[model samples]
Target: MNPIVLWFHKLGSPPYFDRFAARWAPWGHGLGLLLIAIGLYGALFRVPADYLQGDSFRILYIHVPSAWMSMAVFAAMAFYAAIALVWRIKLCEILAMACAPIGAAFTLITLATGSIWGKPTWGTWWDWDPRLTTELVLLFMYLGVMGLYHAIDDRRAAARAAGLLAIVGVVLLPVIRYSVVWWNSLHQGQTIRLFGESSMDASMMWPLAWTVLGTKFWFLGSLLVRARADNLRREAGKAWVAQAALPAVAADPRTEARP
Candidate 1:
């Protein structure tokens, strides 16, 4: 077997991952917090507001990133589901399951922030804009996966069902992306763009992009911590779990007696 596969195989085991997360969690949290602080400062004070939108456009700092994350999480969940379906890997299913609530949380944040922004800019708190409608649908799909997980009694069965749902739900992504073009809506066109000319200036775009990156890091850290806890809970009865859970070289003779 390839070394990379061999390393992954070892890392896939519950104990290794648990230990890895423990070591990495603090650094992840620290980095995320630092980046978020800097990003927020730049967004709030350094960046200038749009001429037309005025102060109301400030909500984009939060709304846009959360919206981006909502879609990103779903896409990630779908990819994980595909991995679980094709390879029948338990780890992939567990990861996909773990991501459901997080994705749903981001979706909710996106909706709330968009609503808040809309109230000031569009004169209402809610609109049936293509992106907003599809995002709500994405949130529902995430809820469906979580509901399915709890509905099934067996862990593996629940993961498989949820994985199937996630894979099937990938259709929502394209719909959300095309919603603005497909229908007339209050939501404006894209502000920050990669290929085309973005309406946003440098100060606004950079901070927003930084905020997005910080959130992505925060999500990774959150997932690692959650996944670690999940694995520890699932493996609680195993001998290795007991050994790994305890501190090293305790000098208690009984600790060695457990295999």
Candidate 2:
């Protein structure tokens, strides 16, 4: 097997995954937070205020990253769901389900931040614009997946059911992405482009790049941590779990004899 494939195959083992997650989760989280802090500082202090929007535009550092993650995480969940369904990989199922709450959180941040930004810019807290409406629907889709997963008694079965919904709900992603262009929408059109020139100035764009990278790292950490916990729960009562817990038990002073 290819080295990459072999490594991935090893990750399917709960024990290997537990170790892998433990090793990397903190690194992902720490780096993510550091990058976000740098990004925010640059956004607030380094970049000049927008000619029209003024200081209020600084919120984009947070808003755009959250908005991007909202959709990106959902797309990742659906991809994992597809693989789990096709290959019956338990790790993929756990990963797909684990993505729900985190994705929902990003969606919520996007909505809230968008609302805050809009109030000053658009003079309204809410609107039924196509982009905004589709984004709202995206939140509901995430909630629905989470709700469906918990409603079932069997963990594996619940994951499968919810994974199916995730796959189906992916149709909303493209709609949300293109809604501004497809209709007369109050939401602003894209200003940043990965492939071509962005309308935003370089100074303003740098902070956004930092924040975007931060969110990706943060999501990776969150996913590994969540999936590791779920994997441990699903594998409870097994020999490996007992062995895994032994070290912690041995290290606890409370586990020593009462003198």
Candidate 3:
């Protein structure tokens, strides 16, 4: 087998995954927080205020990253769901389920921040703008996946069912991405681009880059933590879980073996 494939096969083990998550999750969290702090500082103190929107536009630091993650995470969830449904990979199932809550959170933040930014720019807190409405529906899709996953008692069955929903709902992603282009939207067109020219100035773009990278790292950390917990839950009573839990039990004086 290819080294990469072999590594992934080893990673499928619950104990190996738990160790992997424990070893790397903190790095993701720490780096993510640090980058976000630097990004916010640059946004607040380093980057100049927008000529048109003034300081209110600073909210883009939070709003844009959250909005991007909202879609990105859902895409990831759907990808994992597809893998699980096709291959019956337990790790993929856990990861697909884990992505839901985090994606929903980012979606909520995007909506809230968008509303806050809109009040000043659009003179309204909410609008049925194509971009905004489809994003809201995206949130509902995340919630639906989560709700469906927990509604059933059988874990593997629930994951398969929810994964199916995730796969189906993925059709909404392209619609959300192109909504502003397809319809009359109160929302502005894309200003920042990874390729070609961006309408945003370089100074402003740097901090936004930091924020975007931060969110990705943060999501990585969150995914690992959530998946590890779910992995433990699903593997409860297994020999590996017992072995993994032994150290903690031994460390607790009350649970220690006594003569």
Candidate 4:
């Protein structure tokens, strides 16, 4: 096997991944928190309000990044699911399952922050806007993936069904991306740009950039935490799990109680 592929294979091993997650989770969480704090300060104090929307638009600091992550996580989840289905990679299945709830949580956050931002600007808390409607469907898809995972008693079988669901649901991603452009919607179009002029000025844009990076790190930390816990559960009887599970974790009464 090629060296890089060999390293990646070793990385996917549950024991190695547990150790990796243990070491990296804290780093991801610490840096993520620091960046998020700085981003919040910049968003709240440094950035000027939109000349049109005033203070209400400030929620974009959380909303836009979260919205992006919701879709991005699902895309990632589906990719892993496809790998799990095609290659039968156990770690890919676990990672795909891990992504479902996190993506769902982000989707919910996006809806909430969007609603909060919408009330003052759109004159209502809820809308049937194409983007908003599609986003809600995305949340349901995440939930469906979770539901499918938990419905089966056999672990591998559950992963297979759930992975298939995730793969089929990938269509929602592009739909969600283009909904704003394809239809006349109340939600505003994209303002951030990579190469061209952005609709926002530096003061308003910089904080958003920081937050986008921070949330990605936070998501990494979150995924590692969830994946590690799930890995431990699935491998509870294995020797490596016995050796790797901390005394505090293994001794927890709830750990024994877990089905």
Find the candidate with the highest TM-score and give its number. 2
- Between prediction 1 and prediction 2, the one with superior TM-score is 2
Candidate 1 regions off by >4 Å? Answer: 248-259
Model 2 has a clash total of 0
Q: TM-score of each candidate?
A: 0.92, 0.98, 0.97, 0.93
TM-score of candidate 1 against the unseen true structure = 0.92
Query: What is candidate 1's local distance difference test score?
Result: 0.84
- Candidate 3 per-residue lDDT, tens place, 1-259, comes to 9999999999998899999998899999999999999999999999999999999999999999999999999989999999999899999999999999999999999999999999999999999999999999999999999999999999999999999999999899899888989999999998988899999999799899999999999999999999999999999999999998888888887884669
Query: Global lDDT of each model?
Result: 0.84, 0.95, 0.95, 0.90
lDDT of model 2 at residue 181?
Answer: 91
Best-to-worst ranking by TM-score: 2, 3, 4, 1
lDDT of 4 by residue, 88-200 (tens): 98888889999999999999999999999999999999999999999999999999989989999998889899989888888988999889899999989978887999988
Clashes of each: 0, 0, 0, 0
**Candidate 1, residue 254: lDDT:** 65
- Give the 10-residue window scoring lowest on summed lDDT in candidate 3: 249-258
> Whole-model lDDT for model 3 versus the true structure?
0.95
